[model samples]
Target: MLEIRTLYDGTGALPAPSLTKILREAYDGELFFSDSSSRPLIVGNFVQTLDGIVSLKIPGKSGGADISGRNEEDAFIMGMLRAYADAVMFGEDTFRNAPGHVWTAGCVHPTFEKEFHAFRKHVGKDSLHPLNVVVSGRGHVDLDEPLFRHEEIRSLVLTTEQGAARLHQRYGATLPAMVHALPGDAALDPSNMVALLHAEYGVKLLLHEGGPTLFSAFLRQSLLDELFLTMAPQIVGRSRTGERPAFSGPLELSPEQAIWGTLLSVKQAQSGHLFLRYRV
Candidate 1:
């Protein structure tokens, strides 16, 4: 097991796995948004390589373990964030990569399950499990996957009208609680989708676990608040295949549309990975 040491924290200097104190304060509604009006504060968490690869463009498989080395510290932090969130959100491609997975705290970070749930209850989450939300403009998801079959987690889908119709044909009767389609031909609007999640699900703090393109959408929409990024100690160099970077897709934040964030916190695990937090 790798231990964590805080190099710098905007709040104060403190070490981690004892980092829970910092997380606890954030969970107490102190760190999200001070404003009264907004469509829920959006936070993103990801681990990437020193060379900036999140996952390789392997033919049919997707995993960041090769890049991140599957560090224990990262897993524990991931679980902590899931517990802190009202819902753990993912893009369809990322969810599809793990066919047998659920987005619940236990599923993402099982070793920390007991403590993770305790923290959830500590933060006064009405349900023990955070909702599992997947974004897919075309509703490209595995209806038979464990994301739906999991009894504890609530699941929802966001897609286009035509995609909804197709999903209805395959999973009409057994569809998850909601299948919200975008208006007209407007594909999936990250801001609008997030606003709906806040209005409908009472999600005040949304956490995004991404597959590049989706992260790009949030960036394009300026809906992201905070980012927890783990800088792993490997170098993926370049894609042997035409792979994507940590953020993919057509959405661009050009020079005029640049998004900048202030550095907030930093930590280092024994494995030489650096964990950084940013206020975006």
Candidate 2:
């Protein structure tokens, strides 16, 4: 929609345009932009170095060379995706490690409450707000986190029934009103979860921000519809040693299906980083 053109070398890029213009073109009249049957349009958003390093130091620490000048670009891409999605999905660990601040007018608020009201209004669901879904198998979340105070934004904690019960018993009063108990281990079933969001919550598009384990689960279940990866020009040689990539080990998918990704767009941000979008 943004006048995309494919380069001869097998790459497509979206020309630089104003933010409002880009949104108008991308969404147009489509209330939803995902496959309805798929329900949740899982967009795997992650940042990695040109050499395939997702994080430079440990999972949450910030040290080492910031390769390829990609951090700002990655953040911009994420902000754009957040602006487009109806809901955002993240692993519980991401919350604990790097709890995100609510985005407001192209900026992120360090605390949640100040921007909470405006964020709900932006999504056109001020009554309940766009769902902030967290997948926590063990139900280990800090009840006193700033996210809980924002009543305007409804937070949905997806866990096993047992886990849900534990969360209730521990922080029932502090927890959000919509604590859904999943079918068996309380862990969310991707297919079932997507169905619930569509059938019950009226969410048409979902953006998944991963922390590897959850990413692996979605891929293993074949629930991902698209992947938005930002290949930063940096590398972290140590990341591969301890934990494997999201799709590592014995996962099965035909070569065509497994490697099926169509280039959508590539743009160089003001910070000199590349943003890539692909349909998986």
Candidate 3:
């Protein structure tokens, strides 16, 4: 078992472990234990500061800085978690806009590709890959996107019956074989969607990588199980006046169930960035 500790000095570097290894450890370390009592799915979230401020010094157009050391480390952590998950869930907007290989860094580690391929294999049973679930209401997705072409990932677009029909006609053979049509507005029904994933696909572990709106919806429905957040030291004080954090409005967690996140670890990257993990 990995020992949990706090690093107050924030100067030393934590040993850099393979992303896949770290993810597996995180699950075996905490999630698996929790699941023994209750079967709530695990979910994770990653966000950059408004000033494009992933780092304090590398401020670029997006907000605070270019991809700072902290941002990179958090992203790598998120990637590892995703790799370990049975399925990677995302909002329709995130899917249509994000570039392919959403979590791949430029690192040439031996395990990077291998871990990703494993996830793909899990999704595409028989020759398929790890299920890539996208939530879209209008079914407005681009079939020619590189994400669909990736052999390591199979895309499952969840939309309404009308939208699914339209997408089927438009994309035809390009889309995944299964297009789930919910009873009501598909995008609005996250709980039902999660149940569908578990009941139909046997996806026991679900990691939701969000784009704010989806996060808000998940929280609203009380469907979120656990939250993994990496809080970088820098602040993004601008370019986000109107935007909201993933969770907005009144927090609904009960006093006992109210969020009690345990600090997992803190690591400083070679680029002088800090990575902090909390298990909520």
Candidate 4:
């Protein structure tokens, strides 16, 4: 059993939880989000080191597991969030980096698979797993990946019109997932994507597990609602090569336009890793 100590919580007025007693004891805290019928509530989850390096950018070890050192509590929290989400969205790079990853509550933390499923059922989620959303502006996703091969998991791909043509030519109608062609060139508008998800899929809570650039786009558009950051107790300095990336990339926010977030809750694992929830 992972022990997560709550340092502070300011989310009392958010929403009341109807979680089962088993989940309440396992989580040892309450988490709720504001309702939005017009659009899905966007929440981001990321883990960075003390030096603010999110990815090592190495060939084989560029995922969050290396940053969090495969912490059990962090994985549990990720699974917990997945349980509450209607869909889990990430960039093409994130999907590529993790070869066989599935965006599901049980896939992240297998030990608590039953608890996560129970939580989802309590919340009235009809799907066995949250929808896996891959946002690729250029349609650069590999169709042979496990996520696409898995017949049980519902997947969606959002890309540009040209990208849709490319994917259609490459994979044709044999592609297992739904390929949506949005009106854009290279970059997709985050707001439009959210609106499409809300209108078509009825996604109330969308989890953004980003790969830096995608997160920055959402932040710049002010479409992101909340951020759940895990501060790993390690420092990996940025090299002169500049391959290592921080939380957000490419888009630099000036002092006048900086987005500050309100702290909602703080939790610390026994391994000194801090879990921070913020209302952005």
C-alpha TM-score for every candidate: 0.88, 0.74, 0.68, 0.97
- lDDT of model 1 at residue 155? 87
RMSD of 1: 3.9
Pairs of residues at least 3 apart in sequence or in different chains that clash in candidate 4: none
Question: Measured by C-alpha RMSD in angstroms, how accurate is candidate 3?
Answer: 7.0
- Model 3 segments beyond 4 Å from truth? 1-40, 50-70, 102-111, 115-129, 173-177, 238-241, 244-276
Q: Candidate 1, after superposition: displacement of residue 199 in Å?
A: 0.6
Q: Scored by CA lDDT, what does every candidate get? A: 0.75, 0.57, 0.54, 0.90
Give lDDT tens digits, candidate 2, residues 122-166: 546434345677778777766566566675556777778787888
Query: Candidate 1, which ten residues in sequence have the lowest lDDT sum?
Result: 27-36
**Model 4 agreement with the true structure over 210-246: per-residue lDDT tens digits:** 9898988998998889999999999999989988988
Give the residue spans of candidate 4 off by over 4 A: 13-15
Q: Write the per-residue lDDT of candidate 1 for residues 29-101, one digit (tens) a residue.
A: 1233332256777889888888777877674545655557878778767777788788888888888887687
Q: Which is superior by TM-score, 1 or 2?
A: 1
Question: Highest TM-score, which number?
Answer: 4
Please, what are the lDDT tens digits per residue for candidate 3 over residues 1-280? 2223334322234343223344444323222213322333757655454333222222233221233332544555565566556667777655654545432311212344565556445434243334777777887877666666666556677788877888899878767445777766545587778778787777776777765567667776666666655544555553335332333223356676565566654655444455455555
Where is model 1 more than 4 Å wrong at Cα? Answer: 12-36, 184-186, 248-251
> Residue 115 deviation, candidate 4, in Å?
1.2
C-alpha RMSD of each candidate structure in angstroms = 3.9, 6.0, 7.0, 1.2
